[model samples]
Target: MTTSNRCVCPDCDWVVDVPVTTTEVFKCPRCGHRLGGGAPVSERHTLALALAALILALVSLWLPFVGYSASGVSQTMSLLDTSAELLHFHERLLAILVLFTVWVVPVLYLLAICWIFTRLLGSGPVGPVTLYFIRTVVQLRVWMMADVFLLGALVSLIKISGLAAVELASGFYTFIAFVVLQLWVANNVSRYQLWHRLPHQQAPQSEAGRAAHNQGLSGCVCCQAPNSPQHKKCWRCGETLSLTRWRGWRLTLALLIAAALLLVPAHVLPVMETTSFGRTQPNTIIGGVLELWQGGDAPIAIIVFVASLVIPVAKILTLLVLLYVAERGNDSTVKNRVVLYKVTDWIGRWSMIDIFVVAVLVALVRSGQLMSVYPGNAALAFALTVILTMLAAMTFDTRRFFMPTTK
Candidate 1:
């Protein structure tokens, strides 16, 4: 029912008048979901920040990240050390995930955004290549975790400071700067403006037009290009289009259940084992937090407690509630449910802090009984739980919540 100046709220389906001014930010009145926001950063500034980020990324990878010295032994690790150490220990899946998050995805994210920005700043109208790359950047940005990796590194440093002389190596500070600049770029650069400037050459029909044209249109999952019910492929991006948004509900449920089951051993079993002078102690997630609390690192303890314990539980419970509500066809709370889903999806990856901490410890603390740390069974289980929950969030189609309820 809405026209060019109005859009159906992604959260609630309420028609919203698009804000006019560069300073005017709009939030969905019913759900408080941000409908739109402020102006785009200047192209020159965004491009400069992006290039600086590239430099910092290289320094982060090339230099020694941090070092530990104790009992006449000293060891240092670089950014790649985490994945290399995991692979050396035959944890192939973890190594791949870490490598992807820390290296591959972040690089791809930076490059893809740079490419899109270049196109936006150029003389010619934006093409399919630019649109596809922009969409790709959106997907890759969520999985990039250099910032989380740094947090995990700091927590790991605090945990081992008592047992070893821990030094923040050059790469560590470089990584800190890199993370800050990266976030600045993300915040200052507006994707909305970029999308606006693009020619919309092959974009699917407007939401209002599609609905009025035929109620049977399917939205492309990739570029959101609307296609007729008889069409198998999206007209704009060529992605497959399907009418059944609920097609994979069962798979989402199954993954959620598996993640919940793993959350048990993830908390119950030891995540890391430490052996010092022939005295070995295994610490589960709760035990580790308590240890930090008893050791006077209250802040770090609280952080660990929230990241390792609270986040996983909250993510699982929240997703479960959302799935149930979404499947139930509740009309009134639809917008609230979308807000909840977004929050749950965003925070699920941070639960990997425990796993990252274990990786750094396993790699850098290999002193022979002076202090040696090894990955425990719970590390694998916990990592799997995080991965499963992420998958579950992705499998859930948020558009389903926006559908009209069938009474």
Candidate 2:
């Protein structure tokens, strides 16, 4: 294998040859991470989908997203209201988070895609600005949560359906379209193809079919380009490369510790308070799940339980285990450990579903005495816990799975 076809697996540190002309899906034999050998979607198609999604997003903003009527009182909520109402209650941080994840990030991602592909279509070279936009696109993909927010919105509606008249509006349908188109664009957009189109400086000569780390090389987290450990930045995308294999796990451990501490209050305190006919009841995370279960919405209850309780606890514990495995240099099950890290990283974001539900309910349910919902202290704590766990997983260097013993 030569420099042109050699690629390093980001998850397992395995070096493999990837042919440019192959159309079948490529997977790392060591850890099963997708290496992107499928037929690439055309830049024109991706650009068009992105533009369409942007239009739907803009339209969804001004239109009413959900409408609720109770005791002759009706309330209508637009998509932006979910975050705006949080601000009204002085949850500035939560409001900003919800706004960014649901609206701001997706819009920015779509705009970045449109800009990058437009430049590509013009046959222009990938300059610094285009490279910056490309990096932004990749980073913003995980934060785009319109689809998750949609599920939370539906759950919010279900929680109040028996008490009032609930109706989905034009904005809801438009957002559904936006989420679908956005996912289509995300799934088909190929980072491998994007970087291949750009120019890359020659890498130092290294043997093929061996771990890049063994040859003093590190894979760029941003562009997947192999870089010499001595180089501060990647030759392809200019992303900063990690110089040492043993770095980051200490920080990951610290974050996991903090998240574990916060998990206590996140479960013990109420996530939201409900008021009905001058009566107020505060519901903790598990309390809310139990309410849903006893109300005959067992499926939604199960969904909430897993997403809120099971996933977070499991993710924290799993990351701790991975850190221990990495430190112990247990290469016997490195492959399985890599897969576990990927699963935890992917599922960690879904834990925010409960947060989104709180935001939606706080914004959508408002009626004097008849019924109303207010966010609780646990809302922010739980949000922080989820975010910390996500950062912990990100800070964990997967390459350590293939590392020898660390002193």
The numbered model that scores best in TM-score is 2
For model 1, the local distance difference test gives: 0.74
Q: Where does candidate 2 clash, by residue pair? A: none
Where does candidate 1 clash, by residue pair? none
lDDT of 1 by residue, 1-407 (tens): 21223344433334445553445666766556665667757777787788888888988887999998888888999988888888887788888888788767877777777887787678897777887787787567778887888888889999999888999899988888888888887777655455445333454345442231234445455433345666777665554555335436788889999999999998999998888889999989899999999999999999989988798889888877777777566667776687788889888888888888988888788545587887788988999999898988888766567555521
Computed on alpha carbons, the lDDT of every model, listed in order, comes to: 0.74, 0.85
Model 2: residues with Cα > 4 Å off, grouped in runs: 1-4, 242-247, 327-332, 367-369, 405-407
> What is candidate 2's lDDT per residue for 293-395, written digit by digit as tens?
9999999999999999999999999999888877465656776788788889999988899999999888889445587888999999999999999888878
Model number with the top lDDT: 2
TM-score of 1: 0.87
What are the runs in model 1 whose C-alpha is more than 4 Å off? 1-23, 28-32, 200-214, 222-225, 236-239, 242-247, 327-332, 402-407
